[model samples]
Target: MSERLRLYSYWRSSAAYRVRIGLNLKGLSYETVPVHLVRDGGEQHTPQFRAANPQGLVPVLVHGSRTFRQSMAILEYLDETWPSPPLLPGVARERARVRALAQAVACEIHPLNNLRVLQHLENALGLDADARSQWVRHWIGEGFAAIEAMLAEHPSTGRFCEGDTPSLADCCLIPQVYNARRFKLDMAPYPTIERIEAECLALPAFDAARPENQPDAA
Candidate 1:
């Protein structure tokens, strides 16, 4: 085994979940360093955590002497450094398509619904619980609508987001779908997303990376 790979992760953090899924898909073993975002006014805000990630985000991957942040960056790094069981395709166009689909969830959908952002909507903007819930549902619906359209129309979509093999798209989709389900977002409109998530979850990699399966899960 390589020297212990340390991951700063929060149990319910969808970004962290994406990295965990990537690591598992590569068959790489790692140690979990739980970062409780909700406790003590957000442990990620602490100086030490901030030192690892100036942005104070969870899912920072420390391998050997190098530390990486951003879920998509970490996933791409893992795929590049360890090519076996590749999470991306060999073709340039196909790879771009896969990354775009992943970004639809990671960049476009997730940020607005992240824990810190929601906390801001409550504490900063003074949005009540119902309003916050509406905010969450609105973004999830907008993102999933695009995803559903792509999955339905894209000829590249197969059993998973891209072709039959699980790609970066599946990694991103599963976690976002999990978050959507948590908020009781209606999945009826996104049958393709639901089907893809189900297929990915059936695999050992995605199953093992589930939030509840993590050590820090409440």
Candidate 2:
């Protein structure tokens, strides 16, 4: 029998959205257990949720008896375990390049604009709404500027971030693009990024993983 897959995710969490795209691309069927991040002081802070992930973050994947945390790690695990439609390129250097592109968004951009960070900006640092929005846009713009150049100048760039097929980079990029749109960031400056996002979203797998399409979306 195949192992059961369960995803503990928040509807709007970009990290969770990345995992969802990976799973869908790999043609894996999984159950989504919604963890409302905002209602009632954030359900992710609950004892039960924390027990699943001590970090109190969403996009935790339970496959059989194994539990995986972090979206990028989960994507790697899925690609390794189910190699049919690989997420990373087969060549060593290509794989590294793809991962670096993925991390450029996952590590550098997403962290600064995460929900908790924004919440802290408002609650702890006492930044007003305009300031908070500016903060989000500033970091996204800074990170995207580099990514746009990387993609635009690189010969490896295709319909997707790497080559025509979607990779881990696309999984990370798409969600960050979604978050950018949510914050009303000007996407015209990053034409290459916008083009890649458009290509990815045109595919069924990427479309299915959208935040608004999730089971727990409001």
Candidate 3:
């Protein structure tokens, strides 16, 4: 039986963008239901969206009878349910390494720089625009520094984060790079990171997920 695949997405959301790239890479067709994150203090907080995802986040994938949230979780779900064009490589160690790299960006870097966090820092904590910019740059720099060192020193690194093919690590890296660029962070320090990101951006899947191409992007 053919299953229904639906993605509850926010066009400019880096997390949702990640899922879109994964779906594209796997050649899975899914309808994009845009959940406007910015309108009316974020539609994700509304009762409608909350019923779909208790976490009230976008990038919720409804497949058949199942629903999945969390960008990395959704990617893994897609890969597991449809094993062709695998996103993670063989070998348990290699998979773990790639997952670690992804989490470094998704968990450590993104949480601090997300829209809600920035808004909280400003409207709630009284941080000025300058301070907020610094906050964004600081976390992005820290995360990218670690990723840069990993790619530079680790023998596992190749054309992408792991082997020649783009893996989950690359999926996570590109969105974070996009976020960094949006904030105008200097990229010269992370040559390998920048190089891999450029390579990923050249691919159509990653290009399609870019913020500027999204419906909500201004």
Candidate 4:
């Protein structure tokens, strides 16, 4: 149990950023092995990294002999491995709510706006820089609009996406919020999300996990 956790991550990948927040929130120590996503046609696609993750994605976590891929799965693994400071709520229904909130961002929002999809748009689809930016803003706006309604109307929405404490939902949401702003998406419509993001960032855990704070972020 003395083994140090290791994370293969790209600095600005929001999926990777999500796992970083989860790790920090759990107070777990981990070594980050930087994988440059944009330089030299992407280090993640190289043979060495692909052996660690067949999918060639960021946030492949290694602990002892165990290797975990996919950011949400890694979060669940960490929560279960170190049960104190639970990422999901204790109650079954509450857990479901948290999972749904997390999935809305991880599943709905992220897949549409992730690096690969955007790259495909620009390379394969021949979308200009402006056109790609439009594509990003449009999808993010659509997702945030639904999320805004959910958080605004739901009684469970606290300072974070779920209760006042940062949960699985906030871990997923915070990184996406960062990415949205990077694309310059107009955030005025999602006041609830904006407030929750501010609250989450106030915590040391979330603050430490910002993409800019990552060592590879240059």
Q: Which candidate is the best by lDDT?
A: 2
TM-score of each: 0.98, 0.99, 0.97, 0.98
Clashing pairs in 3: none
Error of 3 at 63 (Å): 0.9
lDDT of 4 at 67: 93
Clash pairs detected, candidate 4 = none
lDDT of 4 by residue, 1-218 (tens): 66779999888999999999999998999999999998999998999999999898998999998899999999999999998799999899999989988999988888988889989998899999899889889988998998899888889888788878889999999999998999999999999999999998999999998988989889
Q: Report the alpha-carbon TM-score of model 2 versus the true structure.
A: 0.99
Q: Name the better of 1 and 3 by lDDT.
A: 1
Regions of candidate 1 where Cα sits further than 4 Å from its true position: none
Ranking by TM-score: 2, 1, 4, 3
- Candidate 3 vs. true structure, TM-score: 0.97
lDDT winner, 1 or 4:
1
Please report, as a residue range, the 10-residue window in candidate 1 with the lowest summed lDDT: 1-10
lDDT of 1 at 55: 99
Q: What is the clash count for each candidate, in the order shown? A: 0, 0, 0, 0
lDDT of each: 0.94, 0.95, 0.90, 0.91
RMSD of each: 0.9, 0.8, 1.1, 0.8
Residue clash pairs of candidate 1? none
